[model samples]
Target: MTFPLRWLWWLPVLLLLQACSSIPTLPVAPTTTPVAGVQGMASYYGARHHGRKTASGERFNQNALTAAHRTLPFGTRVRVTNLNNQKSVVVRINDRGPYAKGRIIDLSAEAARELNMIRAGVAKVRVERLE
Candidate 1:
């Protein structure tokens, strides 16, 4: 059965309304700057992930002082200090993860070793963005 042509006009209006409904009302994230002395938990990437391409498009090196942050831009250098032993390491942001609750950064395996946290697997850390 065929409907009357009058319904054609209503069809376009309905589609327009549907499209407008699909638009997000707010942004998923907000504009922000990296805060100095952000404190949180830090972990490390293991040997299994070495040589993999990171989110920043660099090959992951277990021995290099590199790190992953949730929001820091790639190539941004930061000093990660372990609160337990007061050890610190400078690492460049080369990825984005930890994928763990309450974790702020993910360090390279070597960085973890330098921090004396490889055995513990995680540490309370203070992250200071470098200029």
Candidate 2:
């Protein structure tokens, strides 16, 4: 088999474009004020991640009322209310992402417990940003 040497230059450009496209871009926090709230599935992480560093450079504390949101700015406070149990808790955004598909937020263990959703592991909830 024979390869075309003249076409080699185009290969690098194509590869670079592909690499750029495949790199996932983190969602940017909105510059303007956000809406009052949003409703979606919420989940929690604890124990295993408790001592790890978060995207915001803080240690993850399962007992703290903290949470991860896709684009909410770090230090933003939000109230998450479980639709099923009618329980709610305030959590500070200290990380980025739920990571899991279809989930809107990831909460700390204490926040999950406060919402009475520890057993279910996930819940449908309303998240209201607090000023």
Candidate 3:
């Protein structure tokens, strides 16, 4: 059974609002040079995801010195240092996220190895953008 046509107009508006609500909002990153440094827990992606396409539209290479940052512009280079051991490795920002909570960056396996964090799979890191 059909009701009044006037109510039909509200359907499209409601649907559009629902759709917009579901779209995730990304944090606004600085268009200028990045700030001093970001300190947070970091994680890594490796062989299991090797060769997959990254958010930057490039193939993911676990061996490459690349990383995913939530807000850094693609191709931005940053030095990630493992706070635990003071080991650091420079990685290009090539993707989007760690997805997991409490993590700031996702590193390539090679970067993780360079930072000596593979054993723990995660580490407290200090990230400083490269000029």
TM-score of each: 0.75, 0.75, 0.74
Q: What is the lDDT of residue 75 in candidate 3?
A: 99
lDDT of each: 0.91, 0.93, 0.92
Weakest lDDT window of 10 consecutive positions for candidate 2: 29-38
Instruction: Evaluate candidate 2 by giving its C-alpha RMSD to the native, one decimal.
Output: 8.8
RMSD value for candidate 1: 5.1
The residue-by-residue lDDT of candidate 1 on 62-89, one tens digit each, is: 9999998888889999999999999999
Model 3 residue 83 distance off true place after TM-score fit, in angstroms:
0.6
lDDT of 3 by residue, 53-122 (tens): 9999999999899999888889999999999999999999999998999998999999999999999999
State the lDDT at 11 in candidate 1. Answer: 88
The residue pairs in collision within model 3 are none
Poorest lDDT segment (10 consecutive residues) of candidate 1:
26-35
Candidates arranged by lDDT, highest first? 2, 3, 1
True lDDT of residue 103, candidate 3: 96
RMSD (CA, Å), each prediction? 5.1, 8.8, 8.6
Residue 86 lDDT (model 1): 95
